[model samples]
Target: MENAQTQLEINQCAGINLLAAKRKLVNVLEKIRHAYKSASPEFLTKLDVSQKAWEESLEADMEMKYPLEDKRLQYGSVYPMCASGFESRLVLARVEFLKEWLKGHQDGDICSGSIIHSYSIQRDCSNIGK
Candidate 1:
């Protein structure tokens, strides 16, 4: 729950440690890869990009999810899961943060973008892989 809580803090607060936050993302992606018993260097790059893009989008206060409205825009949804606008932007950015990163390729399919769940947490680890 440590990661989740920290992520929650990032989601709820206003701070842009994008690099460290991104490192956290890499760690989480690495953990998911290891937990799922899947590993690949290429996937790591893709995963890293995806994670970072999601972070960038968050830092930019934008949303990413299932193309919304019509203008051929807005993929996935926004964040905070409560208010709309920037609030939703954060929730969407943080939770589904890995979406666009993988949109460029399918090989590094990370999480299924499901609603954040209980079992999402695992034993904390620093190294994810290369």
Candidate 2:
């Protein structure tokens, strides 16, 4: 019973963190949209392409690291429960990068065509591997 409760708690935590991370990313993207509205066509195109590339890269990385599979009844795979946590970590890293860029803006507005450096936060998933 205790182990079951613990598993339930882990699932819930993962769900909540995933939601929060997504929300943060959305907020950051909205900010960028507002900031880049008046940018040159070429610059805007580049920004759009880069944004898509970043998301695709993140998704590909996640899929590589955590291929969606249910082995819970067999070898006791916890991936089913841990997927949310891994996704949350990735989203949170992007969110943090955006937030830092916003903070560093000199005029309180992200300048059009400005390229902000991307930073990634390293996360240890060793605990989840168990």
Candidate 3:
């Protein structure tokens, strides 16, 4: 983007960045699915449903951001670049959110829920009150 002097060039760069972010998102999601492969069928179904809902939410957010019927006409020439950059940020955020599943929580954390527990730290939670 440093050399993107023209609006067209900037817009193209933004679009390319957006595509890269989307690919990263796909990779993260695949890793998450693989990590939880041993989970029950119902867990997998819920994961799929959650992903679909997140996608719908993302689309709704984009629509709300640019509520006009004709975004290009309403926002002018830079609309494409802005929209692409905004979408890229949102996707990167989602990737970060999904990464927690891969990282997992400490073994003693009882609230870890479905996330795989990490036994790297051997902590005793039973003596917390003492």
Candidate 4:
């Protein structure tokens, strides 16, 4: 059926998008690692350690979103396909967050104490929780 084919395509594309987003996130992290190379030794060590933990957390979160125990028949079920879409969105969010955080760093807007603080606070904070 046409609807089934479309759903399959969407599911496949979602997986590709998720992989691409994850790659982008890793690339951004690598850029950040390089950008902060001149920081103090303590900071560099902390960054390295945190980077490993962050990668682990990402893996864990992805596994949670697509657990193997809940496998659905791909032919008639939409659950697995929808899971891919959700994963794609989550990965894309991480990519955007890293990019925005990098932009904040480049803008020298860290006078607000934290890197993301200035950008988030300066934005229309009213729309944040909405």
Candidate 5:
């Protein structure tokens, strides 16, 4: 019994992108205001455009937040620009980030009961095969 319980205790929540979850939730809420702003068939075609743009803008802002020279020819924003399109982006970004985190911590998910049950099922299948 003890041995059987060993494998099932493998996976656990190591950490998560709270920021990403927050972004997703905000996205869901934002969509409520405009009645599914990004759900339109026209918007779905763009896919991840909003997420990419947000990350890029953030990276740029990080670069520019420092002291800049005289009026530059470049037009840049100091931070992420939230567009009506961003609702979906935020949700996706959050999910991706958390997925990344999960990928890393996936091995931590295990339990003894699950292991035992799996072994039991395998044994049954093997016997059936025989």
Candidate 6:
């Protein structure tokens, strides 16, 4: 990106970055699915639903960010680059959010919700003060 000179080059770089981020997202999702394969069917279904909703939300956000129907005409030549870069950042943020399932939460945390406890950190937290 730093080496990109022309607007064309910059847009190309942004597209490349976006593709890479999407690949990372796919990999992270696959890891989560594999890790939680034995989880309840309802949990798996919810994960799928959540991912779909997030994608829809992201698209809506982009639409809101560039509300003009003729985005290219309104935003000019930099629209592609700017939009791609912004979308990449959003996708990377989503990847980080989804990673909570992989990282999990400490056992005995009441606020942990659906995230499984980190198996490596498993302990009888209730007995900690004993």
- Stretches of candidate 2 off by over 4 Å are 1-4, 68-77, 104-130
Give the per-residue lDDT digits (tens) of candidate 5, residues 3-118: 33322221111012334455565554333323323235544334346556666865565455433453232423311222212433544655564332122222344643112233
* Candidate 6 TM-score versus the reference: 0.87
What value does the lDDT take at residue 10 in candidate 4?
Answer: 66
- Residues 56-103, candidate 2, lDDT per residue (tens digit)? 998898778765454355425455457777788888888877665344
lDDT of 4 by residue, 1-130 (tens): 2344676676776667667777887777775545444445675677568667766887788677666765575324666567766766766776676665355433545462324433433352334224
Q: Count the backbone clashes (under 3 Å) in each candidate.
A: 14, 0, 0, 0, 16, 0
Instruction: Give the lDDT of residue 6 in candidate 1.
Output: 56
Error of 5 at 30 (Å): 8.1
User: Per-model C-alpha lDDT, please?
Assistant: 0.43, 0.61, 0.81, 0.60, 0.37, 0.85
Candidate 6: Cα lDDT at 112? 78
Higher-lDDT candidate of 1 and 6: 6
Candidate 6 per-residue C-alpha lDDT over 1-130 given as tens digits, one digit per residue, 9 for 90 to 100: 9999999999999999999999989987877776666767788899999999999999999999999999989999999999999999999999999888878788578997777777822332223224
Report the C-alpha lDDT of model 3 over 13-59, residue by residue, as the tens digit. 99999999999989877766766667566767887898899999999
> Which regions of candidate 5 fall more than 4 Å away from where they truly are?
1-26, 29-39, 66-130
| Superior by lDDT: candidate 2 or candidate 4 | 2
**Highest lDDT against the true fold, candidate:** 6
Candidate 3 residue 76 C-alpha distance from true site, Å: 0.7
Off by over 4 Å in 1: 1-30, 36-38, 62-89, 96-130
Order of the predicted models by lDDT, top scorer first: 6, 3, 2, 4, 1, 5
Of the candidates numbered 3 and 4, which has the greater lDDT value? Answer: 3
State residue 101's C-alpha deviation in candidate 2, in Å: 4.0
Q: Residue 1 in model 2: shift from native, Å?
A: 17
